[model samples]
Target: MKKEKEIKPPIITDIQAIFDRARQAAIRSVDFERVMMYWQIGRRIIEEEQGGEQRAIYGERLIPYISEQLMPTLGSIFSTRNLIYIRQFYRTFPIANALRSQLSWTHYRSLSAISSIEKREFYLSETIKNNWTARQMERQINSHLFERLLSSTDKETLLSVARNEKQPADPKDIVKDPMILEFLGLKPESSYYEKDLETALITHLQEFMLELGNGYSFVARQKRIHLDGDDFFIDLVFYNRLLQCFVIVELKTHKLTHQDIGQLQMYVNYYDRIEKLPHEMPTVGILLCLEKNDTVVKFSLPENANIFASKYQLYLPTADQLQSELQKELSKQNVQ
Candidate 1:
């Protein structure tokens, strides 16, 4: 018998990409349907309980009763805890048209827990603008990212940036101080070399970029620049599309000094003069140290210099700790 002709798969460019895009679209569609279903369920529950009045008659028992009845069929997702979240999801966003299709149910659940409307709105707008995943959104909330931004940036400007009404004009608006490096899996008590810390940051570069705020793309590590006979290497180099500038980051494991500031300033000047294109903005330098003296930082750079010194922490700060820090910052600003 003649051997059967072997069939081959057709050559298709980006076949994997095609499959990934299709799967993602399917997931998004299903998630959107689930969101709408939950919203409608919540609306029905509210309408039945209220019975055309502003206040509900059933009180707390209504949700439990509904959950107890529906959970067996709908599974654990309709549990009392989740039903409450679903109810809040509807209440939080009363207008169906106001709901963003981009956000998943998980995103809404986390967002509903926020009581402050301004804070909620800020996160909502930012999540959509940044395309943050549910986990990233939760991490930002846990880290008090909103409060951190508020501490450094004007409230109106921050909100305007979130709303896409204005771009960040200054590095302080995006570059986080006391940068959180918890994702690096480093010990807070142990000492680390500058190279070690740089390695950790490079390993967790995605999380690092997220912590860096927005529009940052990694350029190089240990970026070498030759000056006359001397050679200097920057720990990390990044470009911020929003700021339209090269960002030079120097890692200092010890407390920052005037000399460290001068080194970074020189790097910034080199980039501005030689590396930076005419159309690009001036290079900005940041000194990341275990500790920074604001007074030292102030005196080290000129008033108009594009240089800053910020502290880094291995762990995420508690809300109380962040609040205290913000209060201290505000007090200093008021005094100034």
Candidate 2:
């Protein structure tokens, strides 16, 4: 008899990819179930506490007693602190139907910690739209991203865009000034070259893009442009899908200068005239420097120029620091 043909399994990672995806979906389902369970627990706790009264009866001790009772069977997840969080979660989002299954318990916990309704809603919408992890949401909240954006754009427009009601109309709607790059691992006091900064940004490109806000994708780095026998290399190039434009970023390890602005402007002009498609919007230039003289930037560029100078911080600013800076900017705008 002829020898039976031998069969070998296919060599490909697609099977691994499928398994990874299934695992992710399963994890997400389990997380959502945990969220729902916590919500139900919160509701039940609230009902028992209220007992038809405006305030909970012995509210101070009730959580501890319940935690002591549940800990034996339910594990430490029902500890007093967590039980309090669970209770607050329901109060924050009273309507069970309003809870998004896409958000896990951790996400809801971070969101419920927010005191402002509008801020919470903005973060919720953005988390779902951007598919941000719980850690990312926490970072945004910690960085006062909502307040920072509000300083640049109107409240209604900012919220509407986050909610997908409308697209961002201007770069200011998305781009953040004083971008917190604490993730770059660069010390503010240490001296570094522009090339060093650029390399660091490239290394942490994912985090950098998140700092850039929405609708951006990396295009090129050190993009060479030849004009009239002169060769110019742009530091970094990105495309913003929402703005339909090329974003040219020029890194300055020192304070910005008028010449730096001029250089970025030339790059923006070149991209607009030479590389931009007919359907594309005008190119935008961003000067990411350690410091900027807003007065100089104002005078250097044309009134309608799609150019902006933004300061970059090696460390995250405190809430008070951000608020103070925002107030100063608002004051300048008001004066202008």
Candidate 3:
């Protein structure tokens, strides 16, 4: 008969980790129950305030009466203002099952402050998508992150460009859009070339990635490949962590044609087949050109293709110009 060895307890880190998770789950359960209770209370109060027939009852005045009834026994959670917010929460989310379990009562309270249904939904979606804390969500709302991110070529990113200009880097820079380089050195004007544009983009790569979207990072420039004794080069390559895909960007000085689209599709196929891992999504290609023909693009690619052809501009338009263009675009859309 052999004596069994004693089994020791888990380490402190493991114990603490388990404890933390349990504590978080308990908090979440409590918070969810609290929110449900408030919503139900608000609903009942509203029902009581509204008379059974067309005649009115206490209406909004029942708020104070309910608060008075609950304050002594239920505590200060039943204040007039808080009751109003709770009622709004129920009305805003009529479907009881739609409440987000991950969010706490505080998150819902913060979201309830938003007036526009569309804007509120956008924030709610973004907040959950980003897994932001209440403070982070509030900060984003205050920063107008939605508006800033939606705006084309927002100026916030230029701060880095301004800093980079006062101090030159190790590498020699290329002059794109003669206008930009001229602004930098008063150099002689030259034709705007795609190569120059690509070179300039590298210097402002951070800004370019930001404009592209959240989670996009620069991967490579002039990414090269060899296939069947022929070599091909991609202008710009980016990886979006959120989208889990490689984004291939091509710069074209001329209007986009079916041939260019076919070329992009070929590159996308190359990436999807070779560069993408089993867990990664398929590659995406974007053709940024001076002009794009919608018909050519529609006819060139398969319906399921991820390649996109869009117009690009070297210069930033003024606010008024952008507004007027937006209005015209909206009008055209309405007409269509």
Candidate 4:
């Protein structure tokens, strides 16, 4: 007698793979091409209603009546709020060819909230090209990315700046002086030790990583290192995917000193000699301190040093202070 064949159990990984592919395909489908479609629809609706006249009552009573009727047939999809959004979307993005497919409806909705047309356009273009999810888009917007780029570079250089896919070539590019750590909920004037700051950073690691810039992956905290029967603990360790290197960060709650820099260098050397992969770049060390002397830092490292020192603030710096500093930098660049 032939034996009955045994059935294999379904694998969760395989099921998840299928689900992910289906989800991606659905997102890519034009079943509801989001804001772009709505904008076009609204534009067409307006044009037909106008019949080539500029003085048509497009917004007054007509839009409300049409929206009311459309809502019943369209369900919640065509509510008055969405209809208004469609109209505003068209108004915001008058150039049809300029609309990007990668941006979801939510992205467009957020973009529409920005008052400045130039700022909105910058975000729209960058978000689409970068394939940024709605949350990423929102974060960038909140970070004032467009304004920051504009302050740093000219309009012609903006696209290149936005398209940067890796860690900045210069330390200045990645470094945000007085790096904000308000998310950690620590007060600047509060009596805090290095361990306290490190703990806070660990607690808010996700936000810290984003604020740190692209490609930073948490490796270990209070990472232990042994050498010649001695034990040492590095404050935090991370790997930057874009930089392709191990990054060792040493935290200091007070003014940075040559000692801090030297310790960081030792950590960097250790990682380079042992932890770093052969294919990866040399390990980079960052001295995150409350204060730094630029002159001392320049002299402490080699001519083209991979090691860097940056100041970290427990609270958010005033917008005015940041703006003024940016303005000064822009002016100097202009002069050069």
TM-score of each: 0.62, 0.61, 0.45, 0.63
lDDT (10s digit) by residue, model 4, range 1-336: 999987656787689889999998787666346655787777986775667343344546567667778778877767777777777777677787876767777887788788766567768877877888888888787655665454444434433444665435654455445566778898766798888889889998988887777677999999999999999999999888776888888999888888888888899999999998889887878888989899988888887767888787665445566566656766979999
lDDT score for residue 234 of model 4? 96
lDDT of 3: 0.69
Runs of candidate 1 with Cα error greater than 4 angstroms are 1-33, 36-106, 109-144, 147-153, 319-336
Best by TM-score: 4
The residue pairs found clashing in candidate 2 are: none
Model 2 per-residue lDDT tens digits across residues 29-59: 9998999999999999988887745344346
Compared with the true structure, what per-residue lDDT tens digits does model 1 show for residues 237-313? 99999989999889999999999999999899889998999999888888989998999899888897789888887
Top candidate on lDDT is: 2
- The residue ranges of model 3 lying beyond 4 angstroms of the native Cα positions read 1-190, 322-336
Q: Give me candidate 1's TM-score against the actual structure.
A: 0.62
Ranking by TM-score: 4, 1, 2, 3
Candidate 4 contains a number of clashing pairs equal to 0
What is the C-alpha local distance difference test score of each model? 0.83, 0.86, 0.69, 0.75
Alpha-carbon RMSD of each model: 10.8, 10.7, 15.9, 9.1
TM-score of 3: 0.45
Tell me the spans in candidate 2 whose CA falls farther than 4 Å from its real position. 1-33, 36-103, 109-144, 147-157, 319-336
In candidate 3, the residue pairs with backbone N, CA or C atoms under 3 Å apart (3 or more residues apart, or in different chains) clash, namely none
> How many steric clashes does model 2 contain?
0
